[model samples]
Target: MNKFLEQALLFDFYGELLTDHQKEIYEQFALEDLSLSEIAEMKGISRQGVHDLVKRCQKTLEGYEMKLHLVEKFLSVKEKVSKIDDTLAEWECEKNDPEEMVKRIRKIADAIIEEL
Candidate 1:
């Protein structure tokens, strides 16, 4: 994944666990695309301080993902759903046998249930 996108995903999944200050700085730097110097000046902190806070927030968010795997599970489930959609579209276009399509859908559904 793109670095910014990964950061955004981690933040989306675990940002609530961060402190208010951390959230503000992270939102400015990562989400709002502010420069470190700009964030520093706005927050009345040194540029280095702003940078460190953003890095700390990143580490904290990644740690949460490592332990809980909520983001991982969400992505997996989303992919499975997309595959199911693709199968349905293919069935519609090709007019494949209904019994085979049912079996395929059941298999995917079973895997999703197992994961949950």
Candidate 2:
């Protein structure tokens, strides 16, 4: 995944755990695409301070992910659902293989259950 996208996902899953001040700075730098200098100017802090805060927020979010794994589980479940959708779409076009479709779907569903 892209670094930016990875950061965004981490923030999405664990951002609520952050303090209000950290959330505001992180949202500006990570989600709002603000530069460190810009965020520093807006918050009346030094550019390096904004930089440090953003780094700290990323580390904090990563720590939460390491402990909780919510983001990992969510992505796994989402992938499984997508596979099920694709199988159904394929089955719709290849109507001759109902048995195969059922087998594939059941296997995917079982994996999803295991994940949960």
Candidate 3:
């Protein structure tokens, strides 16, 4: 994934684990795209303080992602589903071997169940 999307996903997944104040500031600045000065003015903090808080929150979110690998697991499941879809499409085009297609479908179902 691209850097921005990766960061966004990590922020979304790990953000709830943050402190309430951290969540508020992070949501406003990171997700809402507020400028530091604007956030500082809203929160009654210095711009430098807001900047530092955002940095700390970012580091904390990254730490969770690195340690837990929740995002990695989710991405792996998504890739498997995509591969299954491609295989089904190929089977449909080739119009050959219902047995193999059934087996593939079964495997996909099993994999999705395991993911769930």
Candidate 4:
């Protein structure tokens, strides 16, 4: 996965676990895509301070991902579901053995939903 997407998933998975201050800064910097300087100007902090806050928040989020693997599991299931959808779409137009493909896709989709 792309770095930004990975960070975003991790952030969403872990942001709620952060302190209020940490959540504020993280939401601005990661979720809202604010520049460090921009956030610092709004928060009355130095750019370096804002940078450090973001870095700390990143580390915290990554720690959660490392220990819990919630984001990783969610992403894996999502990918599986997408692949299943693709297979189902292909099976719709397939000329031979479409039932097996459809069954496989249904099973994957069911498993993904169960995980969710």
Candidate 5:
């Protein structure tokens, strides 16, 4: 994964655990694509302070992912769904019995739902 995409996924999974100030700064830096100096100027803090806060937020989000594994599980499920879609596409081209494909897809979908 790209570094920024990984950070965005981590934030999406665990952002609610952050303080509002942390969330705002992180969103500005990560989602809004603000430079550290830009965020510092907007937030009325020194550039180093903004940098430190962003680093802290990344560490906190990574710690939560390490403990909870929600991001890992989500990626796994996403991969499985992609596989299911690929299977369906293959089945369409091969003109195979749809029953088996449907059953396999359902099983994968059910497992994903269970993980959630």
Candidate 6:
């Protein structure tokens, strides 16, 4: 996964655990695409302070992921759904037996739901 996307996912999964101040700074840096200097200026802190806070936020979010694995599970489910979609598309192209295809799709869907 892309680094930014990975960070975004981590944040999405665990951002609420952060303090409001931490969340605001992280959102500015990660989501709003602000430079460290820009965030420092906006937050009335030194650039290094903003950098340290952002790093701490990243570590905290990653720690949550390591313990909870919510993001990992979410990504796994997403991949499985994509596979189900691809299987259906293949069935459509092949024009195979409808009943058998339905059974296969149902099995895949069931597995996905079970994982959830």
Best by TM-score: 2
Model 4: clashing residue pairs? none
Better of 3 and 6 by lDDT: 6
For every candidate, C-alpha RMSD to the true structure in Å: 1.1, 0.9, 2.5, 2.2, 1.8, 1.3
* Candidate 1 off by > 4 Å: none
Off by over 4 Å in 3: 105-116
Clashing pairs in 2: none
Each model's backbone clash number: 0, 0, 0, 0, 0, 0
RMSD of 5: 1.8
TM-score of each model, in listed order: 0.93, 0.95, 0.78, 0.85, 0.88, 0.91
How far is 63's C-alpha from truth in model 6 (Å)? Answer: 0.6
Q: For each candidate, what is the lDDT?
A: 0.93, 0.93, 0.88, 0.86, 0.93, 0.91
Cα lDDT tens digits, model 6, 1-116, are: 89899889888889999999999999889888899999989889999999999999999999999898999999988988898888889988999888888887888889888988
TM-score of structure candidate 4: 0.85
Supply candidate 4's per-residue lDDT for 19: 94
lDDT of 4 by residue, 15-75 (tens): 8888999899888888788999999999999999989988998999999888999987887
Give the candidates in order of TM-score, highest first. 2, 1, 6, 5, 4, 3
- Show where candidate 4 strays beyond 4 Å: 106-116
**For residues 1-116, could you state the per-residue lDDT of candidate 3 as single tens digits?**
77667767888888889999999998888778899999999999999999999999989998998899998988888888898888889998999998998898789879877976
Model 2 residue-pair collision total: 0
* Tens digits of per-residue lDDT for model 5, 1-116: 99999999998889999999999999999988999999999889999999999999999999999899989998998998898999889998998888988998999889888988
Q: For model 5, which pairs clash?
A: none
| Model 6, global lDDT | 0.91
Candidate 2, 42-92: lDDT as tens digits: 999999999999999999999999999998899999999999999999988
Cα error, candidate 6, residue 42 (Å): 1.2
